[model samples]
Target chain A: MPRFSSNHLETLLTAVDTGSFEAAARALSITPSAVSQRIRAMEALAGQVLLQRAAPIRPTTAGETVLRLARQVRLLDEEASRALDGSGAAVPSLPIAANADSLATWFLDALVEVRREADVVFDLHREDQARTAALLRDGTVLAAVTAERRPVQGCVAVPLGIDRYRAVASPAFVDRHLPGATSGRDVLARLDAVPLVDFDRDDDLQQGFLRRVVGHAPRSPRHFVPSSADFARAVELGLGWGLLPESQALEPLAAGRLVELAPGRVADVVLWWQHWNLRSTLLDAVTAAVRRVAAEHLRPSPV
Target chain B: MPRFSSNHLETLLTAVDTGSFEAAARALSITPSAVSQRIRAMEALAGQVLLQRAAPIRPTTAGETVLRLARQVRLLDEEASRALDGSGAAVPSLPIAANADSLATWFLDALVEVRREADVVFDLHREDQARTAALLRDGTVLAAVTAERRPVQGCVAVPLGIDRYRAVASPAFVDRHLPGATSGRDVLARLDAVPLVDFDRDDDLQQGFLRRVVGHAPRSPRHFVPSSADFARAVELGLGWGLLPESQALEPLAAGRLVELAPGRVADVVLWWQHWNLRSTLLDAVTAAVRRVAAEHLRPSPV
Candidate 1:
C-alpha cells in the first residue's frame, strides 16, 4: 500500500468540499492545475478514480472512503494542535446539525454555556431531526442532534432526552370551533371543523397525534408555518391548532394565550446526540454542554 | 367526457394536502367515512385510483393530475370569495417561498409594504432561490422568488431585478492575511492563507467569483454560516471573506469595518417574481407590491 500524503489528502478533501477542482483550488489558495495534479497523484496511488468531476463535484464510492479517512486525519491534527497550543483563542470551528425546534428553544442555551467555557466557534446547520444524521454521513458536520436511534457509521449515539409536545390552540379557537364537546368522540368529530396549524408540508406531528388519540387522521385546512418560533406563534394567533413543544406551550398555557385541547396526551419525540467517536476536546465540551442543558430542560426518556 | 364535481375534487386535494383521508375529512369539517366515499366516487367516475393508501398519503401519477385541477378550482374559489366579499379584514393567507438571502435583506420590506395595504397573512417558506420553484410545482406555495428564468406551468414569470453582490472581507483580516496586494493575482495567491465564509455546503458564489477572477478555486478553511444575516455578521467579525449583498456590504464598507477584495468585479444575480396566473386580486396586489419594491431596491434587469 502506498503511503498517502496529508497534502494530497487535503487537496482531495477541499475539492470534494467546494464541489469543483477550481473551487477547491481557490479554497486551498493553490493553482487549479496544482489541485488537479495532487488529486490525480492520489488517485494513481490509490489505483481508483476518486471524483466524478461534475458541477459541484461529487465523490465516487471509492472517493467517499478516502474522504472519510481524510476527515479523521484532519480531526486528529486539530486535536494535536489544541493539545500543543493550550490557547483558547485558536479554538476550532465545530460544525453541528440540529433540528429547528431545538435551535428555537434549548439548543442555543447549550451553545451559549459551551461558549462561556470554550473559545470554539459554532457552525450550525438547521435541519429536521429525522434527516440531520445524513450531514454526519456526508462529512458536512462533526456532530448532530437527531431523532435517529441507531448511530451513523463511526459515531456514538447518546440519548439526550425526549421533547414532549401537546395539542394546543388559542382559547377562542377551542370555544368557537369545538363547542359542546363533552366526550372524546365529540372532540374528534369537532376536529374536522377547526383549522389546524402544521409546521410545514412535511410536518406530520398533528396528524400523528390525531391518529393516536382519535384513531383516525383529521383532515382540516392547515396553515403551514415553516419556522419553529413562527409555527408556535401561529397556533397562538388562532390561525390553527398544532402540537407545540411542552417547553414552548407551558408559558402560553399559563399566560392564558393558549390552551391544551387534549390534556394528558403528549407527542414525545426522543432525540439523540450523535457525534464522531474520535476523542477531540471541542466535541467533548459540546456533548457535555448539550447533555447538561437537556437534563435541565427536556423530559427523561421513557424506559 | 365525464364532468368533474368540484366537491369531489376538493376532497381529493385535501386528502393529498393533509397526507391522509382522515386528515382531509377534518379540514373539510366532515366525517372520515364521508371523505372516503367522496374520494371513491371520484375514482369510480374517473376509472383511476387517486391516492396511494400509505401513511402520510402520497398521490398517484393520476392523482397528481387531479390534484392540480383541485388547486386551480380552490384558487378560483378564493378569488371569487375575495371579489364578492371585498373585505380587507378577511383576506386569505398568501404562502410564498423565497431565498434566505433575500429574506434577510429586502424581502421583508416588500412584505411590510404589502401588509400595510392588505389584510393578508403571509406564510413565508425560506428556501434557496434555485429550489423555490419546486414549492410552486408541488402546489405547496402559490408564489415564489426564484432564480429560474422559466415560469412554472400555470404561472407567469415577471422580471423582478438584479441583486448584485460584492466580494468583501474585514479590514483586520485583509491586513493580517493579504498585506501588499498590488494586483488581483496577489489577492488570489493569498486566498489560501485567508479563511473563507460559506452560506452552506451548497453555496458556490465565493468559489464562482474566485474561478472567474482568480482562475482557480482555493481550498482554505471555511466557516459555514447557513443563516444569511448571521453569515454577513460572521464576515464582519473577521472570521472570513465572503460574497455579501451590496445592500448589506455598503454600510460596512463606508464605516471601514469591511473592504472590497475585488474592486470592480461583482456577481449579479437576477431574481424573478413568479406567481400563479389567476384572476385573483390579492395575487395581483402582491405582484404589484413586489415589483414596486424591487424597482426601488434592485438594479433594473439587464436589457
Candidate 2:
C-alpha cells in the first residue's frame, strides 16, 4: 500500500464532503487545482476511485473510510488546540448546565462573567435537574445542577442548595371559589372539583402535595402547563392553583398577583452540582464561581 | 444578551480557530471581507469585544464561549445530517468508538459495507476496549466495542466475537537464540532476560503469559512498539518474542515466517458491541452492518 500524507487525505476528504472541488478549495483555502491534484494522488495511491463528480458530490466506499478518519483527525486537532490554548493565562468558562428556571434567572449573569474573564468557553447542555446527571455521565457537560445526590461515574457531586416549592392561586380565583377562608377538609374536598395546573405529564409534585395534604390522590381536573415559568404564569393568570418555585413565586406573592394556597406546607428539593473529575483548571475556576453564586442565590441546607 | 445566528457563529469560530481572518475566511470558503463583517456584526450585537486581533487572531472570553457553542452546533448538525440521510439508499456517516485492534483489522471493511448500502458518514474514535465505553457514555460516539460485559448506562450491548492471542517468535530468532526446541522452565524463565517487543509499558499480556507458562514472571528487556500492526512487525523482525493476535499471525505463519513458540494455550478476549438506546435510524443501520461484519470475520463464541 502506498503511504499517503494525512494532509493529502484531508484535502480530498474536505473536497468530497463539501461537494464541489471549487467549494472544497474555497473551504480549504487552496486552489481548486490543488484540491484536484490531492484527490488524484490519493486515488492513485489507493488504486481506487474516491469521489463521484456531481452536484453534492459523494464519497466512494474507500473515500468514506478516509473521510471518516479525516473528520476524527480534525476533531482531535480541535480538542488538542482547545487544551493547548487554555493551558496559559486562560480563565475558565462559566459553563452551567441548568434547567429553564436557572437559565432564565441567573445563568445569563454567569455568561456575562464568562465574557469578562480570560479567554474562556462555555458549553451549556440544557436538561432537567433530574436528568442532568446523564449529561455529566456522557461528558457532554462540565457542570450540572442536579437532583441526584450520588455522583455519576467519573464525576464529583457537591451539594448546592435547595429550591422550595409552594402551592399558590390567583387571589380573584381563590376568593370567588373558596367564598370563605377554610383550611378544613371540607374546603379541601371542594378543590377536587377545581382545575389544577400541572407542570407536565411527568409532574407529580402538585398532585403529590395535594394527595398528602388531603390524605388521598388528587381527583381535581388538571391543566398541563409544561414550562416551569409558564406553569407559574398559568397559576398567576388564574388557570389553576399549582406548586411554584419559591424563588419564582416570591415577587408575585408579595405583589398579591398570587395568593399562597398552602402557607404552612412546602416542598424542598435538594440540588447538587455534578461535574467531571478531570483536573482541568478551567473546571475548577468555573466550579468555584458557580458554588459562590449558588450559595448567594439558593437556600442553605440544614446541617 | 444578543442571539447569535448559528451560521455566523460557526463562521467566526472557524476563522479564529484556523487563525488569521484570511485563513478563517478560506476555511469557511467566504471572502475575507465577509469574515470581517461577520465578526464586526457579532461584536456590535453583543455590545462587547470579541476577537483579539493579534498576528493570528484569538477569541476573547466571549468569543471563546461562542466558539465552543459553534463547535457543538457543527457537531449536532453533522449528526442530524447523518440521521436524516439514512441507510439503504445512502448510509449516513456512522460515528463509532473502537479499540486499535478492530480499527487495524476488519472494522474498516464493515464501515465500507455500510457506506455501500447507505448514505453514511462515520466518526470513528480510537480508544482502548476498556475505555471505549467512556466515549459512548460521553455521547462523543454513537457506538463502541468494549471489553466490559456490563453495558454502559442507557446503552444496549451485543456480542461481537472473540480475539484469540498466542505467543510466537520468528524462525530466525528461535534458531539463533534457542538452537534446540525447548519448553523447559529455564527457557521460559529466561524469556524476560531476552529482549522482547511490547505494545506499550502498560501491556502485560506477554509477561502474564510467561508467568503462567513458567513458575516465575518473564524478565525480558522490552522495546515498545505502539501500534498493533507495528508490534507484530517488531516480533517478526526478531526484536523480541511477544503475544500476537491470531488473525495477524495467520499470514506470516502460513508463509513460514513465524513459528508458535507456545501453541495450543492461547488467550481469548470476548468483545461486545454497545450503543446508546435512542430512537435513531442511523444507529440501527450501523448496528446491523457491524453485526453482519462481525459474524463474517470474528471467531464465534461458544454457546
Top-lDDT candidate index: 1
lDDT of candidate 2 over A1-303, digit per residue (tens) = 466787886687567545689978976778999898989888888899878887777777677556645544443454456678754322222234776455444444444343334344343444666667655553335567777789886678888787788878888668755678677454565775566777544456777788877887666655554444445655776656887777778999999899887677878877777876655555666677767777777789652
Tens digit of per-residue lDDT, candidate 2, span B166-198: 777888767755666576444565565555666
DockQ category of candidate 2: incorrect
Q: State the C-alpha lDDT per candidate.
A: 0.77, 0.66
- Give the CAPRI class of candidate 1: incorrect
- The regions of model 2 sitting more than 4 angstroms off are A1-303, B1-92, B184-187, B215-217
Listed in order, the DockQ scores are: 0.20, 0.01
Residue A303 local lDDT, model 1: 35
Best by TM-score: 1
| lDDT string, candidate 1, B121-162, tens digits | 566788886667777776767888888789998888998889
Off by over 4 Å in 1: A1-3, A47-49, A82-91, A179-188, B1-74, B77-95, B101-124, B133-141, B145-273, B281-303
